[model samples]
Target: MSSAWGNQVERWRAGINAWVTSETDTTATIRVEAVWQSVAWGYNVSNGVSAFCDCDGSDTPYVGTGGVYASKGETRTISMYTRDFTVPKTGNDRDVRCGAGVRLAGGYHDGTSRAYCSVRISHRTWYQPRRPASFAAKRSSDTSQSLTWAGDYTGLDGGYPWSGVYVDRGRDGATPSNLATLGWAATNYSDNSTEAGHRYDYRLYSYGPGGTSQATDTLTLYTTPIACALLEAYKPTATTVGLRATGAPAYVDSWEFQASTDGGATWADAAFDEDWVCADPPKGTVRFRVRALKSSGGSSPVTLHGAWAESNDVATLCAPLAPNVSAPGVVATGTAVTVTWQDNHPDGTAQSAAQVEVTAANGTVTTADVKGAATSWTRAASQQASAGTIRFRVRTKGDHADWGEWSSYAVVRVAVAPRAAITSPAASQVLDALPLAVAWEVTDATGVSQQSLSIADASGAVVWSATPGKGVRSLSVGTEAGFTNKSSYTLTYSMRAGSGLTLTKTVAFSTDWAQPVTPTVTPTVGDGYTLEILIEAAQTEPAAVSFDVVRVNPDGSKTTLVSGLKGGQTAYDSLPPLNVAYSYEIHAYAASGAVLNYVMPYLLDSDGHEVLSFGSAAQEHLALRYDAQGSESGKASGETFHFALGTGQDPLPAFYADGDIDVTGSHSYVIADADEYRAARRKLRAHADGWFRDAWGNVAVVAYSYQISYDAKQYMQWQLQLDVTETMWEEPNRG
Candidate 1:
């Protein structure tokens, strides 16, 4: 859309200026200004003009749809609209041209048919500041550094305003880490976080609204280290020396010292102790120097040794005599090691003072001074945490300024920690009875002096304690001890050595006194012709018991009819043989398979028929056959013998004889019929050497015989003989 011309075909001149104002990935904005005069080609005037751009090096106008226009013969500028066009994103620099031409109403007019013009486009660039030059760094103090650089806004891009300068700092040629943006006028900065004697690298960058300039060359610098002032060394004795210094700079952590025995020709590291005796300096003149340092680095040594060289020769006071030293051979971590020594002054002079040096396992040496009258010194246990051999040596001074030579070192071992463990009554074990048996063992280098064992209930009260003594590692407690059933306990055993080192161990256990009780059994006949025995009140101490009902068979054998019955079980039915008497016994047990109770010999007759009989209690009765005769008798017998003696006066030398007595019994019965006779015969043969109780409640075994006179006889005579051993109703084979 452009302005229209009045009745004339507007002709454009080639005097146009075009430049790229802004650019993007695919297109650029070009502003155009032109000076033109309208010339009429014919009386047919064009209505308006349109602007266009050619980007492909071809002079042809690519877009000519709309543009701004100027009125005829008037110096006036009007807005113009251009038709849309596309540019290929081929390169960063593009040759773009913008201009206007006549537009016809029917179609686009060729450039040759009318006058058209365009100008080569130029891109615009903004201004940026230049890099700062002459960069430098300097140390201000031990902990701070100052940076200075000469900089200006010269060589700025199109005179654009700059923001500030950026200083980047790093260490040991590393990439820049710290960045500081300062005002344009600021040419220096003070870094307060610098470490003493540490190296730092710095560079400068200048930036503006346009962009940042290239970085300057890096400058490396190191912070200053503190220097020690007034270093001095003195000899306290012929065998020892001392060094002292003061005046350390701020931020200095500690000082390091070096020694030179040959006039500073060669130096060796020396510990920075106030008194150099522990360093073991040589007897001759010694030179010393000192320096100050932080954790980062150390400063140069301050060599002021001219005032510290010792003038007295080391051999003037006579070389030291060996002292007699004695110390413990072994010790525990928290036990002290006592060392004693005798002053061996050759001249018999009274001793004034003494010094003892102790060397730890890690090669650290320490010293202590004592009066001459003191013969022994104790090394504190707190300083013996490390476990290894430690060494001790002593030197004495007898009214002299020089200390004698140290004695041979006495070696003592700091033993590994003593350990003791409970080996019996394992953890979480359950005990059935009292008087717990406790056992333990210990491994230690130092022999035990005293040992104590104590048992405590779950409430932490000591219920029982063993007799306190040494050399016994185990003890037993019985029911007489103060212990409660159905309770948990902890056993603690402690062993102490003569050196006052103690070791302790503990184990936990519980006591369970719950046991089975003899159940009251009630027997009755059931539907299957069996005995139904009910456990009327089979109770247990803690309610976890099992019951077993076993039948003792006639032929010295046992049969378990029922077993593993818990507390909730009540009754068990047992099938038995017919026509023979039987007895039953009940046993109760705990969950741990321990038999708790056993009650025996509950007798009953089978189905109201019997071939034998046993004694009964006051209200109890046994079934008996009709018209039986029985007899009982006793026999006593003995043997006597004599042997001649060699002595004439002795008539009878020896007589070996003993009297014996046994009770015998017999019974006779008549079997009514053949069937009864066969049954009785079978019963007698089955129980012929088996155990049973006689009518008088004595345990006996019987042999029987029966005689039938003829096959048609209706009755048979049965005869039985019993050999009774004891009056007690018990089976010898019963377990």
Candidate 2:
């Protein structure tokens, strides 16, 4: 049957039966059920199975099946060879079969009829769970931890399975000494491990569907505490102290202060206890130290030794000391007191205090403190004993030491007593007028402190007094009748005790006083036609006088010519005045130098004109004859001219001429012959009228045509004839 089936499968394979399905006890089978039968040959089963499934004979499997079959479904049990399923297996066909079975059953099948199939499958993915990130820590007394995390799960199968994170501290991979766990979905966490040091480690992990991933690289952390120390200290002396401290690692919130006077064995709270420190501590001295304390309980202290000193302790000793005194010296009136001393420090040190002692001649002694090195002591008046000698001296001292030796002695002399006396205007004399002069003298037993003189008139009134320092004194008695007409006055003189002595005296005196008088003068005419006068008397005593002149005119006019004359008399001259008659009045003087009376007026002129008179005189004949000779004949012979004249006067001649004739002869006769002649006359009868006169009023000797020629040379021969006579002449009227 196998041979026959094989022949038929081969025929079927060559014919149409190529697809088939079958089941068996240990394998499922598939075959081509239809065959191509020919009429020449009966139907033949051929092409035995094109595709087949094989179970490893676990349960149902088909040994053989042929021809066509209807819808046969198969269930089978197969044993998979683990060796055949191994990756990278040897033997290609066997490996292909194993891989194809797994793929076909697992629902990854391609539409192909094949006896074997094979495939390769793998996965590349990341397993990162939510873990902590940005870990940080803060400084705390207690141990603590803080952290944050990020989450990412991609390219992972079955999504991200349950995941978590944990923190542990350890150097090695041993069990974690300290561990902290965080569940999945947790991105941040904080843990207080109460740990602090320079070295600490932490670990982070990731978990997914596959397994837990390797832990991340370990991280280390460190922490430190705050520090503080001293920064500065100031100590001027054992008692004065100051301190300052600095906070290290951080800032300080406050400060503490304490002080100790007995070394460090005991301490007391300082007056300046405060938190905030200033640059300058309070003034004055005290032991002090300070500690800077931070908010973190950190502190630093600065203790200063020998910090303060007393305020009044002298830094340098160079000031001067007070002065001292030596033995006292004797004192007397007008005696110099000598004081001698030395400075405590001989190098001319300035003294703060000094003093001296004085012993008087009267056995009295006293002490006087000197403000500075130099001092003075004066003698008392009582020390001048019985007009003898007195002496004194001085002493001195200074800051560093006392001075030796007293100053040289000084002495003064006492004088005899004095007595008061009056000197002038004689006492108890006659009556007088005002302004009387009084004088006096004063004396005492000892030196006088003061002296004076007082004058009282008859009316019992004190007129004046000579006080001290004014050596001479005088008084103006009042003009009242009782005082001015006083019969006598009393003068008192006194002296005061200057060196312990005094004296007083009184005396009588009188006055012959008189007042000044007015002055007068006599009028006179002086040189230069001036109307002047001389002062004859003064109207006041001692003849202090002046004079003035006034010209008096006939028409009641007056003018001042001179004034301000001295010497009790004056001479004035050349007084200017209008034309008038004037007179003089003479003044008389009394014994008191006053003007007593004036003389009666003496008239100088009555009509105010100066007059003159001529005496006896007679007239005479004067003749002139014209003698022509040679070519000229006589024109007239012995011409006679007559005129009335007076003594010392000559008669002027008158002559007639028919034609021009030289009058040189005529002028000569008039000049030589006329004595009282007022003037000469010349008459001429000519065809042309002409006349002329000469310097002496004589007619010119030449007469030209229609004019007279009186040339000086032609008149040089003029003479006049005088007649002796006398006549009364009156003064000419002033025009």
- Candidate No. with top TM-score: 1
Error of 1 at 405 (Å): 15
lDDT of 2: 0.38
Model 1 lDDT, full chain set: 0.57
Report backbone clashes per prediction.
9, 103
Task: Name model 1 segments beyond 4 Å from true.
Answer: 1-165, 168-201, 206-209, 213-220, 228-256, 260-279, 284-288, 292-735
lDDT of 2 by residue, 1-735 (tens): 000011222112212122213322222222222122221222322223222333222222222223322122322222211111122222111211111111111111212222222232222223344333444332233265454546444423333343666667663234445376666677655556544222345666656654665665565433332333443445433223334445432333444555544444455655442532333333322345544343211111222121121111111113233233332322333433344444433223355565455554465666677676454444445445455544444445444344433544444445455555656555565544333445566544445577676667777788766575634434433332224332477777776656544567777766454533444555564322333456655444554444334444334544344444454455443222223335433323223323322332334421222111111110111122112111112244345576666666766776665553322222222232232222223322211222222222112112222112233565433333212112122222211
* TM, every model: 0.26, 0.21
On residues 308-328, what C-alpha lDDT tens digit does candidate 1 reach at each position? Answer: 222222221243487899987
* Positional deviation of residue 330's Cα in model 1 after best superposition, in angstroms: 28
Candidate 2 — which residues are off by over 4 angstroms?
A: 1-380, 426-516, 521-533, 538-735
Model 2, C-alpha of 283: deviation from truth (Å): 30
The root-mean-square deviation over C-alpha atoms between each candidate and the true structure, in angstroms, is 30.7, 44.6
Question: What is candidate 2's CA lDDT for residue 642?
Answer: 64
